[model samples]
Target chain A: MAESRGMFFKSAVVASYALMLAPVVMVIIISFFRQEIISFPPEGLTMQWYVNAWERREFARGFVTSLQVAAIATAIGVPLGTAAAYALARAKLPGREAISTLLLGPLAVPGVVAGTALYMFYLRAETWLDQDITATLSGLVAAHVLLTIPWTVRLVTASLQGMDRSAEEAAANLGARPPTVFMRVTLPMLRPGVVAAALFSFIQSFENLELTLLLVGPGRTTLPVAMLSYLEFRMDPTLAAVATVQILLVTAMMLITDRFVRLSRVI
Target chain B: MAALVLPAALLVFTLLVAPMALLARISLNHYSPTELMVEAFTAENYIRAVADPYYQQVLATTLGVAFLCTVLTVLLGFPAAYWLARMESNRKSIATILTLLPLLVGNVVRSAGWMALLGNEGGINAALRALHLTSGPLQLLYTPGAVIVGITAVVLPYMVLTLAAVIESIPRQAEEAAANLGATASTVFRRVVLPLSLPGVAAGSVLVFILCMNAYATPLLLGGPQFKMMAPAVYDQFVRGNNWPFGAALAFILLVATLVLTVIGSMALSRRYRG
Candidate 1:
């Protein structure tokens, strides 16, 4: 009976996974179709959609823009997030709880609200500075960074919270300076967390839409934004093809990252 | 140390808090798209949002969809989470990654996928017809059900991850001990695992609830203009209607609602943890 129960649960898990992968598998299969519309069964399998997707300069531009923005955002976010995490974890700061809550507060606010507020502030800033920041790529990048910073801080803090403080103490006892100890001991220990945070930052920035929608300029649109636009005008296998490539890329990257560092520990 | 704290604090203040403050201020003022700025303060927008039955209906619909989505995510996510937690370590890791796949695609792409799947001649309708599950393609797309399914898929990963973390922390020995003492598997699960995993369940539920409540892209794409959620309502007010104050008021209400839910959720989770 016990063996049967175990087998039952295992099969149930397999079934659940099959359910989860159904849509994604369907998407990939549809992407290979030669048909313009994404019908149930494909008329013929072709690489034409992938070819078309690759040839679409707008998709390429959007991909580049997303990469650049995610990179810049991660660069800005990771350091500040590490600093904030360190301070919160080790320092004797006043209003520590409040500060922590404030840092995490953005997660609570809907992305629409955040986007709206950022849009309003940038519009006001444009007026004050007499510069067109609203339609600038910098504005979109800044918004993504702002929205993503909280996650990095939270992840890094959680990792820091779980680390052994005695290691830092041992480093101090060995006569290492604070910065050296930090660089040598703490940094290596925090490596998994920092990497996870960076990945989170990248994913959040890349996948973001509500925040980016409000901030994206006419010429500078992220892939998600561009996809949304394409979705608005047309619904075809081309978008599916693009989405399939994106899913594959992200899944591969995540699997590769997971090989080196387990995400379960950091998150 | 202070340097780090001060700048980070200032950044949060300037970027997060200041905008809400500015929004509040602007909420008191009147503005139109034709006029760049309006210098007058008025409660008309607030009064309009409050007095208008349409706005009320929108709020109700938004909250209703969010509530339904939260419920569905918790229902689907809890069992998967329990199974993952009870699984072997290797299986757990694979399950964890599989669950997080949806998050990788994000909202817009995920919603777009749903749009394709939920469309009139999409996979879902086609499958239903092929299976003889329906006479013909029912109006599944552009409905609340589609929006709920889309949002649930988007937020499901969050619920699973959060709950799995909490559930995995529970020691297996406790359940095993219960089983060894002649308790049935069902009884052991109900008495030992369920009670112990309550905190995780609570946390996951709260997270899903808050995310679903604040969702915009899923509803906007799947539900279209016909379906209105709070975030989309806020968007329409600011972008289309060009009414900043009303939109700000709407946003403020959303913020307050989110905060209230967070507080309630945390309290409930902590209480469950203690119990």
Candidate 2:
């Protein structure tokens, strides 16, 4: 009786996972549907949507802009967040918990709220400096940088807490300076954690929409935002195609990321 | 040592702190259609948000959707999380990765999938028709039910992961002891595992509740234009109306509501656990 019960429970859990994954699987399957309106069972399969999505200039431009912003934001955010995480974990600074929460609080705040506030601030800053900030690349990347920091601080902090301190202590006893020790021994030990942080940071910045929506100018939209606007005009398999490509891109990156670091741990 | 923290300190403080302060200030000012905003010390924006029936309805809808999603994800998530927590390392890693994969994909992409699945001519309606379960396509999309499902899907992963981590810490012996004490399997779980998992339940609920309240893409894609929620309403003020002051006020209102609810939820759960 107990054996049968266990089997039943196992099957239920499997079914639940399947339900969670259904939308992703459906999106992939829909990408190849030949029908434009998207009916129940696809009558025929074709690669036409992929071609159509590729042909759209907005998607291509948006892809480039997203790549640039995500790259720059990750580049800047990872190191700064790494330093901050290091200090929080090791420095024993006053009000560490409060400071850490303050730094990581952006993750909890609604992106729409943050974006609106930033837009208004940029407008005011523009008036004061007699320069444009809103609807500009620099402005967009600045907001995205905010998106990247929390993840870096999180993953790096986890990495720091789990690390062995013997190596750092030994290096300190050997008369090596703090910078030299961090550069040589501590950083190399932290390679997996730092790499994972960078990868996830890039993904977060790239996929962000709520924060990026108000900040993008006429020509500077990100891919997710571009997908959204296109969605406004058309509801077809073209988005499925774009989304499938994104799924593939993210899967490939996750694969690469898993090789360097066990992403399941940090994520 | 403290110097290492300065770069991130400066980044957040300059960008987040300064901007949010400015936003808070703007929320107090008055919105002028022709002038954009006029600097005035008035409680009108907050007053308008509270007094307007439309906004009141929006707040209620947001709370309703968030509450339903929280309850659903927790009930649904607990079983899978328990299974995950008890799994072996070899199988667990694969399952864990599978669980986290959806989160890496943006919510927009996932919402497209839901849209296709729930649309009038989409798969579910088609299946129902083919099965002779319904004569016509049901109005599945653009409904409150659709929003609840979308938000639940988004937050389910968080709930599962958080619960699994917490449940993993509960020693297997605890369940064994309950069973050894002549309790049935279900009784052991009810009395032993359930109470021990309260912290995770509380944390996961708060986390999922906040996500549902601030859900932007899912509700917008699934709920259609007529259906209003806090996040979308916040955006509508800035984009469509070009009303910064009112938008700021709405945004602050949302932030406060989310924070207050989470605190209350945690307190309620903790109090129950203490007893």
Candidate 3:
């Protein structure tokens, strides 16, 4: 009886694995479906949806926009976050907990609420500055920068906690200047954390939708927003093809990330 | 060194704090079709939102759904979490990667995947028919149940990852000891594994519950427009209705409720499981 019950438990775990992978696996399979209506038996397989998704102007445009925004946001946010992380870990600054909480507060706020508030504030900013800001690329990049910062802080902080600071202390004791010690010693030691931070920062900014949804105006949609808009108008396999492409992209990066850093540690 | 923190502080302040402050102020003003918003100091938006039966039901439904999904994710998350925690080979890395894959896919994309699977003409219905399980396609999509399923799928990765981390810390010796004392399998689990894992359960539940409470994409995609949840309702008021004051009020209400309930739930869990 115990043996049978153990088998039952094992099967339940296997079944849970099925539940986790089923949808995305289904999505990958659906991408090749020849039928647009998505009926039973899946009609036949074709790569036409991939071609169609590729040819769509919105998706092409959205891909470039998402890339640029995610890149810029990561570049800008990661350095700032790394600096902040270092300062928090070593600076002995007052109200360290408070500062850390303030920096990470956006993670706690609902993305939609943040998006709506940012949109409204952009409107206020536009009128005050007498310039268009809400619908502009800069506005979107700013919003995505908020997305990037938290991931950078968290990953870098985790890596920092594990870091042996003795190298930095040795370099300092040997009479190296602060900048030299930081540049030559501190940075090389933080390579894994920095790389991991950049990877996740880019991923977070790239995959973000709810925060970017309202802020994205006409002709400035991110890939996820483009997919959402496409979803609103149609329910076809083209989206599956597009999603498969995304899954491939994210998985590739994650594999590359794991080559250098175990995400389980810092994640 | 503290000055190094200025750049990030300024960015967060500009983007999040200032905007939230603006939103709060706007929430106190009155909405006008003509002017978009007219400046006034009033609690009328909050009053109206609280007084409305429709908004109240939306809150209730959102709460009920969040609670239900939180419970489901914890229960379903345990067995997989245990497996993930206890695996003893290179395949453990593969399993971990597989678990992380869904999380890397955004909620919107995952919801789209779930949509295809749960639709009337989709895989589940197709299988049901092939098995002669039903005469017609079941009403799976565009239901509260569908939203719950999608939301659970979205947050389950987090719960699994969280529980697995905590469970990995627990020694196998406890379970072995219990079994050595002639305890039944169920008793060993009940007396050892379950109690030891309660903190993981509590943390994962609180985290998943918050994610569920503030969920926008899964609810919007799976529940269709007819079903109202707090996050989507806030979106509708602002985006579709152009009612900024009311939208801001709703947003604050959602935030407060999420925070309060999370605190209460975690406290209750820890208090009950002090053993």
- Candidate whose DockQ is highest: 3
Question: Looking at candidate 3, what is the lDDT of residue B43?
Answer: 98
Residue B189 lDDT (model 1): 75
Provide i-RMS per model in Å: 2.3, 1.6, 1.3
Off by over 4 Å in 3: none
The DockQ value obtained for model 2 is 0.66
Better of 1 and 2 by TM-score: 2
Please give, for residues B1-275, the per-residue lDDT of candidate 3 as tens digits: 78998899889999999999999999999988898889999999999999999999999999999999998888789989998888885777778889988888787678778888899999899999999999999999899999988888888999999999988888989888889999999998888888989999999998899899989878887897789899889988878899999999999899889999999999999998994
Q: Between which residue pairs do clashes occur in model 3?
A: none
> Positional deviation of A67 in candidate 2, in angstroms?
1.4
Interface RMSD of 2: 1.6
Q: CA lDDT of each candidate?
A: 0.79, 0.87, 0.88
TM-score result, candidate 2: 0.96
Q: Each candidate's TM vs. the true structure?
A: 0.93, 0.96, 0.97
- The alpha-carbon RMSD values of the candidates against the true structure, listed in the order shown, are 2.7, 1.7, 1.5
lDDT of prediction 3: 0.88
The two-chain DockQ for each candidate, comma-separated, is 0.51, 0.66, 0.70
Model 1 chain A poorest 10 in a row by lDDT: A12-21
